[model samples]
Target chain A: MIEFLQYHLPVLLIAIPLIAAPLAVLLSNRYIVQSLALAVCWTTFGLAIWMVAIVNQSGPVSYELGGWAPPYGIEYRVDQLNSFVMMFVSGLGAMVLTYSPYSLKAEIPLSQHYLFYPMYLLCMTGLMGMCVTGDLFNVFVFLEISSLSTYALISLGRTRRAPLAAFQYLIMGTIGATFLLIGIGLLYQMTGTLNMADIAEQLEAQRLVNDGQWAGSRTMLVAFAFLTVGLCIKMAVFPLHTWLPNAYAYAPSVVTAFVAATATKVSVYAFIRVVFGIFTPQFAFELLPLDTALWSFSLVGIFLASIAAIFQQDVKRRLAYSSIAQIGYMLLGISMADVDGLSAGIVHMFNHALIKGGLFMVVGCFVLRLGSVQMDDWKGAGRTMPWTSFAWVLGGLGLIGVPVTCGFISKWLLLTSAIHNELYPVAILMLISSLLAVVYVWQIVEVLYFEEPSEKAKHATEVPPLMLLTTYTVVGANIVFGVWTTYSAGLATKAAKALLEGGSL
Target chain B: MFVSIFILTLLVVTAITIARIGDLWAAVMFTGIFSFLGACWMLILDAPDVAFTEAAVGAGVSTFLMLGTLALAGKTEKPTTSSSVVPLFVVAVTGAALIYGTLDMPHFGDPNSPVQTRIEPSFMEKSQSDMHGLPNVVTALLASYRGYDTLGETAVIFTAGIAVILILRRSNDGFKSNDVFNSQSNSRKGSQ
Candidate 1:
């Protein structure tokens, strides 16, 4: 059993959700289907944790599908980087699934309840599978899988605008996917292999022979360009973030929490893995002004998205725009292009997921009780639904990088990295963005806790126990990860070490 | 090169026509024509697999979905309610930038290009050792060397199916009225 698991654990982590996804629609009883999906999520979550443990003990773990060898077969790679992402992805999956039933019961139509389970499970399969795969083109395939399911899942929102939002996402997502395909096709043509490790070695070797001219081919440059743009768009970086707010604001609150936490983070991982992993930082940064481009785009995203977030009256929309700004922080770390910076970025990915996931879940609780999430509807409701409101404030602090919350840890790491590099402006900008966060968060706080309780909010009570429990669990985790930085930061350091060393494989 | 250029010219012309035409139905049909022409261009570039996908997905699935949408929403082009200059400017800038970026690329299909000399030939040799010989090598690559990608593709298609069900399933009324759908489609075309 140990030997079998050692070989198949990576594939099993992906396949479990996939196998369960199809089975989700078979049950007529929605309860059974939800239970099955929840079970699948928890199982995958367990597998991800175990997989991370195994990877830690034994360097990188690689599984070749159908006994095929590397450079020739499909490879599932679980290294420090991916294992870290895997734990967050599947862990977030389980947490979101745990919280979903309560939100789903209140929000989604009954006829669509069974439909939701299948799509949710399939989306989980797509995200997990995307992170686990090692092949470059394979990432594109899994991106599509996750993206398609996400579009459908978002369209299942109760509002008429849901389908329109889903359609908008589909258009943008397909364009991104096509760009990815074009980029991968170009890379395959240039390097003659799809396996990431093989491509890296070949490119590295060719650079040595041709004094780097071969690696500097315009085709190579274009390939990198397409891949970067495609992925940045998928990551919702700066100008490419138009599709995000609507999709998040209008989707079912359960979906908003899940996709908000997992989707863009996975896309960011893909960008890091593809651009920084296969392209190798030496070639990417030297041959191109990639860092300058990243810094500019990310800086703009931080200020612009944050300012936008503050203007939104709808609480979910506010959080949605805030997500774009948080993503900018992650990108700022990428722009630093060193081990310390990378570690900061990866830690933020994990911690931000917890923060945003919990915050959105809090929004879910509000929508569940108040029937809408506008700021006016939440007035003085905090006094009535004290527990849920308190959890929201906790999550809001994490978003603001408050002390003793996970958000603070990542922001501090990012700040130090920025100042270490003497990018004083960047450091100041990060501070400004964090302050922007405080303003928006405070605005919501005042409405919820300070203002007169509206008549609509007069009857509001705390959300159901299960929902509140899950939200508080994530909120507590934000603080725990913040205060006890040893675990999350340690994994992030391991991942950063692996990524910046041109990969262990 | 001449044949490919001829096909390219036709494609460009078709695209221009599709854009200029105000009749939505005609534009949709022209889009199918453009897709077919694109598949032909892909064939000229010696990428039959990509051509197949473009034809099936672009011409087949997309056209069908557009028709379904037309059945629900009026197909006639609304009056130009939005400004065109900003969009046009954006396209111009982007197109110019793309053209500039291409200036450094290797000429098309240069035999000694890095593409031919790089990692793929070696990867092919490595794959030759597997039981599956390179009979229709793209298939081998897709099925064996990249089996997980194929699995992902299956998931993508499955997700799309689910999306269709989610968006369309809730409204049972739309499916029952073929006459209304057809009349709506016809009126839209008539207005155009």
Candidate 2:
């Protein structure tokens, strides 16, 4: 049993949910579907934890699907980098599932509740598969899996415009997926292999001189360009982020929470995997010069999206814009191109998932009782529903990089890296962006805490215990981890080392 | 090369016709025709698997869905005499970039190209043994060597099915028991 589990755990992380997804659809009872989804999520999370530990003990583990050998097989290869990500994605999946039932009940109609579980599990399956697979083409297929599920989940919102929002997202996502497929096809044409390690090996060999002059072809460069641009669109990077705000804002609350937590983070993971895992950093940075573009986009995206967030009347929309800006911070860390910088990026993404996930859950609670998440609707809601409000405030603090929040630690790591790299201006930019985050978060804080209780606010009550419990579990982790940063930050640092050193020692 | 060029010219003409047609349904039909031409092109290029997917998806599924959408929104497109400057500018820039990017690619079907030289030889040579004597190399690679990708594609299709059902099917309305391609009135009858 132990040997079998050791070999098969990675695929099972995906299979458990993929199998559960169809089963949930077959069953009509909403409660059964919910329980099944929750069970699947927890099991995947447990498997992720167990697999990561085994990987740490035994260095990188390579499992070929159905006993096919590498360079000719679909490889479920886990290194420190992806295992760290696997843990984050699956753990978030489980936590969000715990939080979904109450929100789904409140937001989705009775007849549609059973369907939501299947979609949610399918989305989780897509993300988990994307993170674990070591094949380039497999990433695109899973990306579509997650993207299609997300569109449907978003359209399940009660708002009249939800379908339109979903349609817009579907169009943008399909275009992004197509661009990605074309990019992967180009790579396959160039390298004649879909396995990432084999491609990396070929590209590295192609770097050698035919007659001492640089032998790498421009066709490969174009392939890299297409891949990067396609991933940027998928990741909602800066100018390509037009489809994100409305999609997140208009989606049903549970959908937004899960997607905002996992989808973009996994997209970023794919982007990194393609760049650093498949193509060496020297080639990416020196030959392609993408870091320059990344840095510029991150700098502008941070300021612009944060400024947009500050002016939103609806709280969910405000947070949606804030997500774009937070994405910029993660990009900023990645653009620094060193171990410390990469750790900062990875840690910040994980922290942001928890922060943003908890924040969106709070919004779900507000939308549940108040039927709206506009700032006006929140007038003195803090007084009426103290626990939910408190959780929201805690989540807000994490977003603002307060001292006792997860956000602060990541920002500190990022700032120190910026200074160490002697990018003084970037250090200053990081500080300025945190202040911008504070301004938007403060707008939310002022409404939640300072305003007088409206009549409806006075009538508001705490969300059900399970929902409240789940939200605080995430919110409280932000505070607790900020004080003791060894585990989370340590894993991130190890992941960074793995990527920078090319593999685990 | 001659066949490919002829198919390519036809494809360009189809696209231009699609652009010029004001009848939305006709444009959709032209689009399907274009996809069929593309599938034929792929078949001539010796990628049967890709040709099959393009035929099924680009021609079949896409046309079906476009028709459904046309039925939902009115089929008749409004003809506007608006200036096409912005669109033309965007098209020109995108076309220029794509053409420039294609300059570095190996010419069609060049056996000596870097793409044909690397990695594939090993797969083809070793597949009889490595793939456990699978008769078809592509099937072996797709099912065993690249099986994870197929799994993901399965999820993608499954997700698409669930997505369309969620968006278009009214849950528990009894109409859902009717086929998705059924006309609205037919579904209404099922609901009744």
Candidate 3:
């Protein structure tokens, strides 16, 4: 049984959710569908943990679907990088599922509860598929699956503006996906394979034959441009981020928590995979001056987005902007193009998912009790719903990169990496961005503690214990992973080393 | 070759007409015509299967749905006051970039191209031996080798269907099957 599972787990991780998605709809009973989704999520999380164990024991694992070998059939490949990513993503999905039922009651219409589960499962399947699949075209297919479901999920928000937000996202997301398909098509035209590793090998061979000049080909350059721009749009990097704030603000709280945590992070993962795994680091950085471009964008995005976050009155939108700034930090790490820097990027990605996801869950708790996500409405919430507000404070500290928090570890690594690479300006700019985070986080703290209670806050009480438990579990994980660096940071360093050394040990 | 050029010109003209028309009803009809022209071009390219599918699905079923939507919604589009120059410029640049990228591509029907040389010949051979000499290699590959992609496509369609129902359904009425059933039966009785 163990051996069978070890061999088949990668495909099963994706296939289980893909199949369960439709089944959740067919079952159609709210309670039944809810439990079904919960079971599937926890099961996926368990499988991810088991897969991590397997990958740790074995270097990497690849599965060929339908008994066909790779470069021919679709391949699901999990290395240290993706396995670590899959672990957090699935774990977060399971956590959100646990928190969804009660949160949905307050925000989502009861009639749409069953429909929501299937969409959630579909989104999970798509994300997991993207992480696991080695076939570039397969990634596109999964991207659409997740994106379509995400649009529907976002439109299920209580406000009428939800559909408009969803429509806007649909337009942007479709364009992004189209660009990605064009890129993959171009690459396949050049290399004649959809398998990522095979494409890399072919490109590397071509580079060698051309005396390291093949990367300068117009076709390759165009393909790289399209792919990077497509991923940046999906990642909501700076100027392309017009769609994110409203979508995150209007979606049901559970949807916001899940999508904000995983969607952009997965896009970042795809960006890393393409740049370092498919195109060599030599091509991405040295050949194209991409590092300079990335760091410039990252610096501007960090400052501008942080300023935007400070001006937002809606708490969810504030966090949404903060999420963009956090993404800039990850990009800054990637721009460094060294082991410590890449590892910092990877660590920050994981840490931000936990922190932002936990913070959003705290927002859900407040929404359930206070019936509003506006800053004024949350006035004196700390006095009323003490536990939930405390959770936010804990999550807020992580966002501000306070010492002994997960956010600080990533920030510390990023700072040291910048200085180590002798990019003092970049290091100083990152510190200033953290101070900006302090301003926005302080805004929330002031309303929760200093201001007098609003009418809603006076009536607000602690959320249901189950919801509180799940929120605490995530926020607590931020601290746990912060202190116990052996798992999160350790795994990220190993993965970065492997990625920098041509994706193998 | 002359026929291909004529069809291609018609396709471009139809596309521009669809964009320019103010009456949504006419625009939608132009869209159907545009898809039909695209199908004809595909047929000329010897992809009869794709042409047939596009004709039936894109031109036929999509037009029917558009007509249904027109019945429920406005027949005319709302005019936008925004400037068109930026959009036009963006489109021009993207088109130019794509053309530039294609400049480095192998000529049409070049056997030395990666698509022609790599993996496809193996697919052809495998289709012959694996499926008792399947006549259509595309079908064999789609069904047997890359069936998971087909499944993913099916799931995408399913997601679209579910999204439509979720967005369009009246939440106040609830999604219970009895409500749907009673409404259908009532309509039948009224007709009778």
Candidate 4:
């Protein structure tokens, strides 16, 4: 069994969830289906952990689908970078699925419960597929799998705006997917391969053949631009973030928590893979002005979106805006284009997933008991539901980059990386942006604790223990990973070094 | 070449008509026509398999689904009050960028192109041996060499089917007259 798992874990990690999705629908018993979905999620999470261990023990693991060699077949490649990402994605999927049943009771309709489990599992499968697949077109295929299911999951929201939000997301997501396909097609035209490693090797050979003029090819540049923009939209990076706020705010709370944490993070991972793995940092940063452009957009996006978060009245919407700003931090780290900076960015993906996933689950608790996500309705919630409220405080502190939290570790690494690169001004700007996080986080903290209890808050009690336990589990991970930098930051640095070593294979 | 040009022209015309038509029923029909024209162009380009799939899936099935939607919903589209300048500019810029990118591409059916030179030769020989002498290489490739992608494609269709069911299925499929649902839907209605 051990020998079997060593070779097949990568494919099994994706296949388990993909197969369970349709199986969930077939079962059609809400209770049994939910249990099955939960089991599948945890099982995939276990497989991801095992895969990570195998990768750490070995170097990188590549599995040929149906025994065909790569560049001619779909390959599932798990390296330090993606295996790390896969672990968090499946980890959060398991956590959220655990928290989902009780919270989903109040938000999603009972009749739709069975359908919701299938979509959730499919979305998880798609996300993991995107992480593991070595083929560029395979990325697009899994992107659609995740995206289509996400739209369906969002439309299952209780509010009337859910369908509208889902429709808007569907439009923007389709455009992004189309742009990505066009970019991949253009690259295939240039390199004649869809496998990322082969494409990278082909590009390197072409550069040599052209005496380093290959990077200047208009087709290559156009493909790079399209892939970056398409990924930016999917990542909800600032100006292109119109679809995200409404989608996160209006979706069922569990969906919000899961999608908010994983979807954009996976897109960011994809962007990194394209830029570093396929395009090479030297080509992206030196041959072009991509680094400068990325940092400028990321800096402006951070300040703008962080300020926007302060003005949002709905708690979920505020968190959504905060998510955009947090993404800017990740982008900023990427722009630095060094081991420290890249690892900081990668570590933040893990940290922010835990922080934001925990915070959203807290919001779901409020939505469950208080029946409103409005800040006014949540006044004095801290006193009535102390545990859940304290969970928010922990998550909020992590968001604010307070000491003894995972958020601080990423910020510290980012700060040092900036200063190391003689980017003092950028460092200061990052600090100022952290202050903006404080302002938005404080606004909620004040409402929850300081203000007089609303009628709803007064009547509301703590959520069920299962939901609260899952919330704390995620929130507590923020602290645990915060203190223990070995797994989060250490693994991220290894992944970053591997990525920068070229081709990420 | 003349027949391909005529089909391409009709494809462009149908696409514009689908975009400009006020009535969605007509728009749907025009979309079907556009897809059919596109498929014809593909066939003229010697890709009958692709043409057949596009015609059956894009023109036939999607148009039927759109008509079903129109029957259930309304047929007319709402006129936009917002300015079209921004969207028009965005579309023009994207189209220009795509054209600029295409300018560097090898001419149609250029044998020296990387796509033709690098992999196509090997695929022909590989299919005969690896695919057990399958007559059609496309089928062999789709079913064997890149079969995982086909599985993913099937999963995409599955996801879409489930999405349609999730969104359009009757709300009261199960849990008839449960007080939990009653109160929840009532609150939802009140919130709306």
Q: What is candidate 1's CAPRI-style docking category based on DockQ?
A: acceptable
Candidate 3's displacement at residue A443, Å, is 0.6
**All candidates: DockQ:** 0.31, 0.33, 0.30, 0.49
Per-model TM-score on C-alpha atoms: 0.92, 0.93, 0.95, 0.97
TM-score of chain A for the candidates in order shown: 0.98, 0.98, 0.99, 0.99
Give fnat, all candidates.
0.46, 0.49, 0.44, 0.55
**Model 4: lDDT of residue B136:** 88
- lDDT preference between candidates 3 and 4, better one: 4
Q: Write the per-residue lDDT of candidate 4 for residues B1-192, one digit (tens) a residue.
A: 889778888888888887888999999998888888888888888789999999998999999999999997889999989999999999999989988888888778897888877775478788898878888899999998889989999999999999998888757444333222112243334322
Determine the iRMS, in angstroms, of model 3: 8.3
For model 4, which pairs clash? none
Model 1 TM-score on chain A = 0.98
Q: Which segments of candidate 4 are over 4 A away from where they belong?
A: B172-192
Better of 3 and 4 by TM-score: 4
Write the residue-wise lDDT of candidate 3 on A1-505 in tens digits.
Answer: 9888878999989989989988989999999999999999999999999998888887888888988887778888899999999999999999988987878876666887888899899999999888999999999999999999999999877666778899999999999999999999999888889999988988888788888778436788788888998899899998888899989988889999999989999999999999889988888898889998999998899899999999988899999999999999999999898888999999998999999999999999988887788887889988999999999999999999998899999999999899999999889988987999999999999899999999989988899999999999999999998899988999999889999986551
lDDT of 3 by residue, B96-131 (tens): 878888887777768788766778657888779888
Off by over 4 Å in 3: B173-192
Model 2, residue A332: distance off in Å is 0.5
